[model samples]
Target: MDGMQGAAGTVRSGEVIKPAIAFESVHLDLGGREVLRDVSFSLPSGSFGCVIGPSGSGKTTVLRLAGGFLQAKNGSVCVGGVPRSGPSRDVAVVFQDYGRALLPWRDSYGNVSLALEAAGVPRSERKDRIERLLTTVGLGKHLHKYPSEMSGGMQQRLQIARCLAQEPRILLMDEPFGALDAMTRQTLQDELLRLVSDSGMTVLFVTHDLEEALYLGDVVVALAANPGRVDRVVTVPLPSPRSQLATREHSEFLRLRRELFGLMQDGHG
Candidate 1:
């Protein structure tokens, strides 16, 4: 309860602030099917927000909208107070499918270097930056390994390293750890928390696991499908840095889980 704190609603005294990401009554239609309906929420700077609900609840769509990969038909999605037009260097995404997200042809080092290349970092500077990024994600020794040779967790870590190479201010993660086993998933969850804390990056994570959402989020936003919309937004009051066992056993965590489970059940019914 005392290592680090979730910054969801905290503001320093006398500090006027704006949300890092804001969705204003947003509406979206994909292939004539409404995916999101009048959805709205705000993530404070440097806070971790988790989006959760029943399957097909537009959780990934919301992340995509925030990342500027998709546009809303009505209302607005803004980052740093500006309307999102398209993909920006300041934002990076970590997708659930690391196998697809990573380039199998490239080694770990080369994969991370791709970001630097896209950013136009000179050839001379790419080595140190790429090495640092891969090392930061615990891929230091596996730098020469291709995606096909790495384990699922390692590939996901490499994907994250590639994202970090962009030096993004905002990170959009769509179930990035869903494919891993429980232990690997928890390990990556903690790693992600540490990385975000160190970098002060605003994160919007989408996950179907209730415990995973509660464990990583500063605020949990529940959406209801059949035209996904915000059904509830609960601020996590638990202290950080959270532990896999202890935090999960915390009274508040259990309470929120029960509440979210009911909401999700209602959403599906």
Candidate 2:
């Protein structure tokens, strides 16, 4: 989030985790319209950060640049300290459309194995890893179930398992929980926290929900819509081991919520 971040992130005891994702004066355009301008931010290693904005704020565009699906028209976008021009195995994306993200014909096991297959993993070494990933995502019992057989949450979980199969160092999630019911969304949020903590992976998540961003992020980056540029970068000071009930009810959370709400509405830093 900031220089030598500790306590909340993986860097500790004078250790410094370099920014896994750095966008320096990044500029992008599509179809003759400037989408982003002079955008700059860095996500510290093992940190969970969110990008929030209204429509046309370039939130998804930022994620796409980070994931190497797009490149900056000016300046630089780097992942794992290297300039991103294309996709890498070190980076994996989990999209908002869990339904379309998964293969309809592939069972849970088959879907999870897709990543390994793309990487040319041998058939012998695939089963144990796939099984472990499915279990981690709470899909062990549904290993053979097709995408159509699972609920929205389960489908999302399977997609995550498939992504994790890549053994990625950074996870780029674009509102991966937006489609689920409230109860299921909260459940997946907690599960994601646990998963990230255990894996110690750096995350750059994009969401329009302020509460969701605050709940999951070590830092929140707010963008203004016109020409899509950074408005503010809010560091989360809420205590670690964040709980849905306690953290949401905390004064800090409320204060930050108000702060971001005004920013989003006012379209200013």
Best by TM-score: 1
Q: How does each model score on TM-score?
A: 0.93, 0.92
Residue 135 lDDT in candidate 2: 98
How does candidate 1 fare on TM-score?
0.93
Each prediction's Cα lDDT score?
0.92, 0.92
Cα RMSDs, all models = 7.0, 5.8
Q: Which tens-of-lDDT digit does each residue in 64-114 have in candidate 2?
A: 999999988899998877899899998999999999989999999999999
Model 2 poorest 10 in a row by lDDT: 8-17
Question: What root-mean-square deviation over C-alphas does model 2 reach?
Answer: 5.8
Runs with alpha carbons beyond 4 Å of true place in candidate 2: 1-17, 267-269
Positional deviation of 258 in candidate 2, in angstroms? 0.7
Error of 2 at 77 (Å): 0.5
lDDT of 1 by residue, 1-269 (tens): 33234353254431457789999999999999989999999999999999999986899999999999998879999998889999999999999999999988999999999999999999999999888888899999998999999999999999999999999999999999999999999999999999999999999999999899999999989999888999989999989999998999999999999888987887667
Worst 10 residues of 1 by lDDT: 5-14
